[model samples]
Target: MQDHISSLNIAPMHSPWIEFRPNRPDAQARVLCFPYAGGSAQVYHALARGMPENVELGAVQLPGRWDRRREPLLTRLSDA
Candidate 1:
């Protein structure tokens, strides 16, 4: 999966923080999206698809969700 993402130029800002759906190296703007309560990075899939070509979409992947289900959940903003 990592190889596939790399091929499409989807690079994570910080592997544990932001997951770019389809990173655009030459994008004119970047939008970082956060999921709702109990949601995961996938929640932004549709938004990513609807964004303009020049706008890059990055989905924030909070710990304790999705692949990070085993990790401890952050209880405070300061913990992030």
Candidate 2:
């Protein structure tokens, strides 16, 4: 079962994927991690150490509150 799915190209498809490349250059699989809304990227800093030797850990950094302080947040409600 695993072999069949592995045949397809399943690279990181998540938006703003945090790439945590392993020290080894010949790694096989990479882990794509995501955070919930209003979450910061720093939360996943220690994820690299918990992952397997062959698997690379990656966290996505979305631009909203923490990353972009200069940018103002928009709040609007649309009524039907």
Candidate 3:
């Protein structure tokens, strides 16, 4: 079953999922963000302001919120 799906362009997402906005490939550094409970990746949308040009940012959306709501919630902090 999995093999059949792999034949297509579809691919599974890896963990600590990041948003798919246009990325800054030349960035010297990257930021991995985690919002407070009940918050979504959108919280960091405005965080780019005033940051250095070499800095890039990525936000992690916890389960049960935003687009990932269909997924299960993190039952433990370490699991997040």
Best prediction by lDDT: 1
lDDT of 2: 0.55
lDDT per residue for candidate 3 within 1-80, as digits (tens), equals 74553354423234547762335665555667878878998888888554566566778878888888898987998986
When 1 and 3 are scored with TM-score, the better candidate is 1
Instruction: Spell out the clash pairs found in candidate 1.
Output: none
Scored by CA lDDT, what does every candidate get? 0.79, 0.55, 0.67
Give model 1's TM-score versus the native structure: 0.74
| Model 1 Cα lDDT, one tens digit per residue, 1-80 | 74553356443354678887777766566788889888999988888888888678888888999988898999999976
lDDT of 1 at 31: 85
* Regions of candidate 1 where Cα sits further than 4 Å from its true position: 1-12
Name model 2 segments beyond 4 Å from true: 1-17, 21-25, 65-80
Pairs with steric clashes in candidate 2:
18-59
lDDT of 1 at 66: 97
By summed lDDT, which 10 consecutive residues of candidate 2 come out lowest?
A: 71-80
Q: TM-score of every model?
A: 0.74, 0.51, 0.65
